[model samples]
Target: MALTPLSWCVGAALALVCGSSWPKMHSALAPENEVPLRPTTWLPEGKITSVTLPKGKTRRLYFTLKKASAMSVTISPCDLPIEWSLAARTLKDKPLKSLHWTTKKSMPEVWWRGPGTEEKIHSFTGDAVNTFSGPSHPRTSIYILRLRSKQQSTRATVYLHEGPGPSGTFPLLPADSNVHTLGVGMTSVTLSWAPSPSTTSLHNAENSYNYCVLVNSLQNYPSLCAAKVSMRKEKDQKQDKKERRVTVWPILKEWWWQQWDTYPEDQSPSASLEDEYDDLQCVCDGTDSVCTVSELLPDTQYYFDVFVIDRLNGTNAAYKGTFARTHEEARPAITSLREGELRWVTFGDLRSNSEQFFSFRPRGWQQSGLLTLQSCGGGDKVKVTVSSKGQVLTSQGVGGDLVHIWLQGSPSYLIHLEREGSTTGQISSVKDQALPGALMASVKMQISSAYHRRGVPSLPSTLQIKSFNRLRGCSSVTLAWMGTEERSLYCVYRRKLEKLEAEGVSTLTAPCLGPESRSDTERVLCKYFQELNPRRAVTTAVIGGLEPGRAYVFDVYLMRRWGIPIKYASKMVKTRKEC
Candidate 1:
């Protein structure tokens, strides 16, 4: 069922009049003179009491009813009742955006589904509106809204009727002088009248108020209007001053834009920017200050000067600056095989003369230096070295200080480098894929000694082990060997692999090397080993608890002797748990 828009059909059918006869449900709800409606309802089950519809920026309805909440009845397009349809035709007004009829039952999902959710037309079945529930209170509807001020007209009409509905028509608002303060405490004020005398968005109404105080005191007349307007004009003048003055950014030499700002007021203007930064770039874009140099490659150094003309001052202001070259010349980072196949890489090293520019030989210490890729991915083991080999193109001369990195043929690995480095320009990295060159992989004699000289002993000296078994496993049958682990305080650990589980070492003895002992020492060692095998290696040394009847796992190792490898027994065994 649909209700009609608020209005009466002049020459339409008699039954078409709002609240005319309850003979049948109306398709629409138009304004009714008076009609009987049911009482004791949250919505206007009966005719709604006359409501005053305010106008202007704010428009709303106010009905004097004994209900805690309200349901905004509406005349939807479809299913308009006979009377509703007639009233709708008679009334001409703004088109509707959305309208919904609701009942209390649908309150919970109201905020979610919104106003027009119900399907069946009108008759106020308490459809969706009944469902619209809020904090036991409904937000007052505000319409005729002004976006900027959010102001609405205060004039709208309301229909009053007897419930089970109303009997006759009546204006809800009584004539009263409504005075709202405008620009309180200010000399000048703006006032507006709501429910504009002329209705609609295009028609604006002028509602004026006379200030009693200003009228009584003629002395302050200038302060209230005309003079105040003059003051406002002056205020605007001050604001425009900012637009008149233009500040110039300092010029820098080098190609990149300098990463900096003008010096603080206290800092000397002529103070040295010598090493502050070398990053700056500028585009003169063909103006009077049009760049003397037009075309340039990316990340290149540049210095420029422009004679800025001051239209107001009629003078030339010189803007000069310098900046360094951007990173146009990039060498693949230093990352390569730590072992396996060798992939050669170079950074800041010797280059053939043809590819040289302001070349300077790298220092002696730099010969063995490693360059950080800043970010490297996969197994990209890299080494830095100078090659006098003939791999230079005649035109591209390499400089002594420049390290021209050539991906020697296609290697087996495709390395991806992540973004790496410090905020302050550190080093650069590259993503590369290449095949292995004739310079096959080999264990460098120098590197072997280098590792040893660094106090790193051979792997054969200590049998601490890469792992007892799989780095991630919990089976108890496993055994660990020890290399030179005689003095090593050995312990065993167990935990559910993959799943989070507690790991510890404990003690329980069964068989040694499979029911037989290699020596008296083996027996004692094995016995003690069982005693402390499952102790909480990190927290305690109870040489603690172990499942008495199950064979517990153990790992053997010597502490601080990591660089050395110690010999090991095949597999020290423990018997089933006795418990």
Candidate 2:
């Protein structure tokens, strides 16, 4: 039943006369609560509070419970249609972004549907009864009752009455503060925040503090508690069925493989779907305020919410805002070190605790090479890691006056140099490797390799045209090639020969045209197409829809891994007059 203003006053008088004492629910009413809920407007147990909700504004108020009970909120005799919801508040001032409510910056009092409550809207025109279970004792559980005015300002008397229910106690946790990004790398993000402030000391069962850092790729934040946010399993069966059908056609299958190979693995379709829900990787169980989330996609925005979780009681609270973006993958500077050639690379403007990449292609390495590092009076602040084909071969710190890493094999290698220490800020985590203090350092890198006089070839193996047949159609032909280089790509270029021209373009003398060639009778292959088949070292390509009876010059070039395409083989084939 709804309580009127006169009836609520009479009830307050009775409670005052009986000398009944209730815990003060409204302890702190700062910007966290958003609404102008003062300490005087607190709703005592079994009493009604009158509040005037202004036009186009939301009014929020919270009440406390001393024991486990069924609670309900009743709003009566209002002029305009008001939208209101009763949500169990956990982690005061922490806003849980929901699809149901409009989340404002100042209004940290967003609605979070607890497990015991069936999230519903109550208004004066419809059903006003709401019942939910909440635990009490050890500490009071605060529930936020928000009333939103739609049409105009209206005065309403809100009554919050609790009844008897099963007795229990809920864990009381405080919200974290200053949640922000400390630093970001290609695949990692470092976060720093302050611990929650609580007066009551936690017991043995509620002693463990597992600070869960929920990361979401979307703009919205995750839920405060793990129970509130339900993570769903990804459904990939339908996608697998579609991929099987696409593989039946050879052309489509080849195109799909080419696209997949070129696409970054971090930004794939499956990667986006997997990040829709929250994961448990970023949980900082200890009291450390710094956490580095690793294995994330580069050049992407990620939202973070810190939850103070009590493992025993399953209670949690969300921290404030945490939004940071990872940086894009930096392209390494390529440097070709010839035999007996000494190159001195210096890093003068490198930032603290930041990484820089350098690609070193050593030619004619008859034996292992030597990489020496020298610190420029800053006592070895740089660490060097040498890797080949995405595999780390060795990593060492150049803390001493001299450091050397013996490079083995003649394959192309990569050198990752990272500077340590922070010139500013409290502290930062690099892949969870913490470095303290505000220090700056520089190092000079020198690389030299021994080799034979003969130049070691870094080019792809031979590519020979096997056959070019025009029997398929007058405008189409099947071209096949053989190559020894595995995972080699090819770009096909075609040029039509003039009919009246007496000079026949041979495979040797014919000019290998790029996509930009143009003439009256001779036309270039307009489409910038490249074929890749990782399943085989050699393959066949079917070229169709061409001008019949005209001789065409075709050139095939093997594309290098990081360089321009080199001319491998060429063939001149005339299309048949008819099929």
Candidate 3:
């Protein structure tokens, strides 16, 4: 016969056991003797079935346990006394624990004794219960379900269910090794490491993983910490807080600003997201084992570390940290020259349309100054414009060399040169003729002002402080100056702006009183001084070890041969806060 409907068998069994007339068998029924049973045949969880039972016959079914720790089976509405048993065996056919049950007053419920406490089994008339509980054992195991009846022909339905498997935790993987710096530069470093041993295993167990390279400052700069600021994504917020902790310093703002100095293109009002992303320091692929970190400060020491993060498990492991230092900045070359008694200052391969600025203070009875430009090569013609304090001087369509003389007026001037096409060349002062090789394009100037007689004492031209650049988060400042005189000594002095102001002294006038003639306040605060070489027409000084977040006044003095002060210049600047 074909298999019977389990619902029909259950209903019929209930009526027969209750003393009512036997119900008709389901149209589709299969004899117990004919039902297929095998040692490897396993029913899916929550499966139910019904079959006709021949007198004194038995049938068995099999299932494999994986991750699951226990198994349960139930039989209900049986017309005859039927017995059911469940047994477990290892993959090698070794027998484990076994259980048996028979029909009772109510439906029977049975479960394995594993992971959880034993549950009370409830039974009713015309029902059978069978359950097997035990350790799932190592690896995999097979389970067998056996059913039999001793009385006359009857049918019963069997229902099977399995408990969930145990939950697993992330495994501890080996950390990365052989971490080293591949390359270093003034503002960037490349790093590499051996593939993490646990990488492959993690990939097999999880969907994905990523490598995170961290850099910290080894020096006094607090902003250089390894766990400091970095490019982050919104999705990272979901990660555990411990995995996201990073050390940061307020001065980092200046460091980052210096790293990515504003470019002309970026400064435009119409910038886009794509542009911003492209301008980011460095973007390494998540899957890459090596990465480059950029936007770093020059001449700085930093500690680097590499770590792996399991995306699926949200855990991180770090490699050993390494140290690296960036190279120092290169200085520009300078050539000195003289025209009669006046010294001419010059330098550069000034590009077309690019402007150069210089500050100068003429003597008390100064008259005029001469500006000269000579093309080294490239373009055929050039246009040079010199402007100062509302006064303008333009020389256009000139080839080879050009000269423009003007009466001294303002204390500063801006020079701009342009060419017709995309040609490159250099321009320098007429006095540079003494130099042999082709001169790099440059602009030179010599002021023809009134001067003191032979042995007479007189002050040098006023000192001119040109530019001041403060390094972010550090106690350092780079100062550039012009209007330096030959045969004269130059001294740079700096002091706290607050102290200078409190003493009712100004850097411009204080130095004129001679170093010893100053009051205790002026002498105490302005004690830091450095003598610059007189040969340098244009000079740049890097002053470090200043107090952060404080303002200071700087003075540059031009001293005569007799040790008498001539002229002095001053400027004020503030240093970045913490870094």
Candidate 4:
């Protein structure tokens, strides 16, 4: 949902910004056959909160509301010989009934769908097919599909847009777009805007940028994401008029992770951009899985964007960043694990190709089937596993943009994909390797990638649960463990084992450790993990006061599901007093 092609400014500089509350701004104003724009419901005056993706195709366009009423979106593609598709669903997973497409693209052939609504789409290029097949369309953009609560947690909606390749922060953007003052050191600011969940391959887009900010409270930031803007201009700040626009083509490194202590006499695109552009996408190239957050600076208000870099004609987006004096660290550091890593998600072999149907016949070859890694943020990457069962494809890591992952895929007989995400995570256009002609499948591929963390974190691993003991009257307990000793950060969890009643989940949200450790120095090391040896120094916990002879049980947990789940149920154990 990039800004609609509509230009609000009559004279560019005279643009009038318009956006407010949802029910009021995007409610339906246009009637069914209205050919012209309505004052209240036109796209320029409406709000689009979600986008959906059915299996087999990347998301290209989505529905928007002129005033909370359903409105059809029309795309022109603007001189580019690009092909696109559409996916839609209710935020609650309900299949949207009635709606169809017909095109006139002539050359590449056309395909379209819509079972309920038989409106014949007028097209000149390809054949049309019905897309709304059945129920359970693998929930691509789950956020916009689900009901959201302001306090519980933010949900996310995902989209896969067409791209020139890796286009992140917009090219030719005004230099001051990201300039901000905050005015006050530590005040909360609310940003309302929209982004295009384009399915275009990150490798094809030449310019792009997305806004990302760490939000506090599962309630305040309940949308799972805020906005994806190229520049980070603080509401309205004043600076020398000369600094308003700067040619950023030369200094692209500013988009990645780094310090901007030295303002370039002129901005030079960071070489790192070119070094990693070809290898970026929300997921590992040639695979359905996506790349997660790779690096993040602690305690910095990073004005961030995801951009695809462009070159002699390939796609690309540049990573962008900005620092603010006072804003809480909004997201789990690139080093910290959010919530899903320890959870479970699966990836299956791509089953649908664009060519099968007549409505939207996607080229099975040009658009290789994809396996998606659930997003960390609607369009952010997540931790994914892509092992060839018997083959060794090392983790290559994400390039400059936050979406891409570098890996090797070739030959035959050895291909798989898996991912984990929910409304709390992100997902976007994930790239899969082009299917190789059986002859060149495997050849000592150096591809390497695993769960992409936003910052430096101890890799997730399996753990062995040891014995547990009771200590004080305060729901006291002790446990032993050993794993991820080399991790730069870690978190611990404790829960009563009784809740594991067969096929069940636990209502747990308790911390076992303080904020992540900043350094692995000797003093910090000794304070965290000590060698108790045979004694098995128990990691103890004492919540409020408990009855002396009460029975209690505890289970030690980690943010990772690397090993068999460990538990110590209170109902299964007795609470000891001064034992």
Q: What's the CA RMSD of model 2 in angstroms?
A: 28.8
Q: For this target, which candidate reaches the highest lDDT against the unseen true structure?
A: 2
lDDT of 3 by residue, 248-332 (tens): 2112223322221223443421222223323334333344667887777899887776655443333334466687999878633
390-475: candidate 2 lDDT, tens digit per residue = 89998877642346566767577788878764344332221111111223344555565634223222333345565545344678
RMSD of 1: 33.0
Report how far residue 444 has shifted in candidate 3, in Å. Answer: 8.5
Model 2 weakest 10-residue run by lDDT: 245-254
Error of 1 at 104 (Å): 99
Comparing 1 and 2 on TM-score, the stronger one: 2
Model 3 lDDT at residue 421 = 40
Sort order, lDDT high to low:
2, 3, 4, 1
Cα distance off (Å), candidate 2, residue 368: 39
TM per candidate comes to: 0.17, 0.27, 0.29, 0.18
**Model 2 pairs whose backbones collide:** none
Candidate closest to the true structure, highest TM-score: 3
Task: Report the Cα lDDT for residue 391, model 2.
Answer: 90
Off by over 4 Å in 1: 1-302, 305-455, 460-480, 484-545, 561-579
User: How many pairs of residues collide in each model?
Assistant: 134, 0, 22, 142
Which ranges in model 3 have alpha carbons more than 4 Å from their true place? 1-179, 202-207, 215-288, 295-303, 328-330, 339-370, 374-579
